[model samples]
Target: MRHDSATLIILLAVVALIAWFAPDVVLIVFAGCLLAVALRAPGVPLARRLGIAEHWGVMIVALVALVALGLLVWFGFATLADQAREFSRAVPRVLERAGTLLEGLPGGDWLKGQAQPEAVQPSARAAANFALAGVSGTLGALGNALLVLLLGLYIGADPTLYRRGALALLSPGLRPRGEATLNAMAHSLRGWLLGQMFGMAFTGVFTFLGLWALGVPLAALLAILTAIFGFMPYIGPVIGAVPAVLIAASHDTSLVPWVIALFFASQNIEGNFLTPMVQKQSSDVPPALLLGAQALFGTGLGFLGILLAAPIAAAGMAALRVSYVEGWVEDPADTDEKRIIRPA
Candidate 1:
């Protein structure tokens, strides 16, 4: 027993070291696993209904997704591209306007002085360097995304292979529990992903309509950003709202209130109505814990960390409950009810 505990500690230490050294790689692999779960979540049931193999269902889903994505790009890419360009051009003007507004406020003279050539030159140089770095970073990110997609497709096609490989790493006595833990983790992650999908879709569609109704510039771009960021929970919506509010303030001060109200309404609906329905059908992560996880990951690992934080927290919670709580603490013969994590 002591030897086993030591081995577990050593293994954990090794994992920590690897994660510290290659955090990006770890995040990429985790993201791929998440994508795989998403693919399999619907595919498995479809396969059962169709009397087809699971892999075939996954393949069909992948193909359908690709086709849909291609169609969207074909039809909407030009408009989105134009809007993005306009948004980029508008941002500098918005910042300039904001600076002017700030200058009109109390302590404006000091703020104005701080913006003089001495401070501006270094910022300009930094911006140029950042732009250059950004190009390479974007290319690298695209490459990483492609890699993740391919990995996801492969794993989704034959999850059992990977599952068996993971189980093989454990002792024979521990393998059964490890397998169960893995199943629970996957269930939790799938539930989280499904809920996030609904939230994102709802937020994006409503936000776009609201912005368009208000005649806000770059509605499409802003909506897309809000939807993507919706994956991150509480912090995400706020980050997504900043640009929309800035643009609205710059375009027309009157429109700012309406834009803010639109986002607030969207969030209220999602938080109060949509999220509860989803949680009833899936695993629930406490809001406080979720936020804590987001902060920890965001501060430690940056954006990719923030993006994957919720699922990681969900899976981690599921594993602990299944492995430690149930295995060690719970009385199996007791009639007391316990929450079970399951896929929606």
Candidate 2:
């Protein structure tokens, strides 16, 4: 018993050290797990219907998704390409207009000074370094994305293999509880993903309609961006709103407030209405906990950290409930009335 405990502690310590030293790898793995869950969500049902293996279903789903994405790009590429170019052109204009507007306000000169690039030009060496860094960053991002997709596909193909491998790490006595905790975590993650998808769809549709109504250019592009960004909670919506607000401000100063109001309304509806409705069927991760996790992970891991924070928090909460709360805190002997009664 003592040997098992010691082994578990050492294992945990080794895992923690790896996480601390190589957070990027950890983030990539977590992202792959998330993608696997997403693939499995549809794949499982399809497998049952088609009387095929789950892994085969997952493969089929992945192939179909890739084909659909290719078709979408083939069809929508021209319009999106045009809008993207227009968006790029509009950004500089927006910044210039913003600088002008800032100059008109009190303390605007100081703000503009702070906001603008430094007057001093960079040296050749510095310029080269900056360009190198940008290229490296872009390449690194693409590499990481490809790795994530491959890992996700591999894991989604045979999730049970990974599950059993994980269980193998635990003692025989603890494997059942560990498996239960893992299942709970998976359930929580799935729920969070489902809720996020719904929220993103809701935000996208409403944003496009509202932007179109308000005569915003690149409504489709902006809406797609907003939907994509909606995956990250708290900070995402705000970031998503920035391009639209900037474009609106540049186009017609009057449109800015309306654009802001539109996003505010959409976010409120999604947060207050859609999210709660979905949370009813899943574990409810507290807003404070989620925000705290975002802060911690974002500080440590940057953008990917923020993107995965909510689902991590959800899974963490689920694991706690199963392993700690239900395992020890709840008294099987106590009746509902007894549980509710406070000590005098």
Candidate 3:
């Protein structure tokens, strides 16, 4: 199909504005849809047990999931807020320990003389701030999140509506292949969500266990950080571990280096084995391309782009397979991809 220049420009501008205005909402909606996909299987059992219709059953589960998520956030934030207060009071000791440990490194002599970077202590701007940050975050954005939450419910409870609506809007010649693409895309998204949650739980448990064993303070709060960061796929390991290292550094100067190194080691293990293996059972997305997309579109879409990258790629894979392999369209340059579809 020939692309329209004006139309393309308009679309790009709209997308850019949306990305700028509401990145968080978009990612939340994407996440909610993914969660719905993951839970679709259990809807059947839930419906039977609750004596509700399929759609209602799905909504029930979705709300329950959202509520549970909210409660988890509430508790986690509360815990972190408490930790921050305690940590702030103990900042001098932590800084002294960190400086002592840093002095042993290659640049130790110069570093120990200087002050700890405020960077290590999360500033008001950083998300690691106290629950007090939530009020700032919600200022005018609460409505957007609520809208996305509602949209997610409608889409999740009966995704087929959107699929059919989208399929109907496609060119007649492309509808059959598009349907196939949607099916595959949904499956891949569902699998990715399942794998993601599983990976998060695994990471959280491992981090908590490691920190607790090492006697790190605020182990629960640190585990939550690990799990939340793990949402970003390959980038999560480092993001999750940074605070833990700093917090640990603050506690015992001698243990800082070991703690940092161990965090990296655990991340390596999870990336190389746990996450990939679980995700592989769901779908096969190459790590190189995943990271590349994260870097590229992430610049354009920020966190929303990063979160949606894998799902979009999964959809593209489905389209390519159904269009070329299933013979829905002809690839003029490659005879191998010529596909014929007969109307029913």
Candidate lDDT (C-alpha), each: 0.85, 0.84, 0.69
Candidate 3: list runs displaced more than 4 Å.
1-32, 39-41, 48-51, 70-80, 90-136, 261-265, 324-344
Q: Provide C-alpha RMSD values for all models, in order.
A: 2.9, 5.0, 5.8
1 or 3, greater by TM-score: 1
Write down the TM-score of every candidate: 0.89, 0.90, 0.73
- Residue lDDT tens for model 3, 56-77: 8777777788899899779777
Clashing pairs in 2: none
lDDT by residue (tens digit), candidate 1, 1-344: 56655655676788899899999888999999999999998888999999999999998998999999999999999999999899877866676656666777798777765644344445778888989999999999999999999999999989889989987766666666677788888888888888889999999999999999999999999999999999999999999999999899889978988999999999999977897688564568888999999999999999999999998999899888877887658863452334443332
Assess candidate 2 and give its lDDT.
0.84
Once model 2 is optimally superposed onto the true structure by TM-score, how far is the C-alpha of residue 324 displaced, in angstroms? 2.1
Could you tell me the lDDT of residue 317 within candidate 3? 62
Ranking by TM-score: 2, 1, 3
Off by over 4 Å in 1: 1-7, 104-128, 331-344
Cα displacement (angstroms), candidate 2, residue 177, comes to 0.8
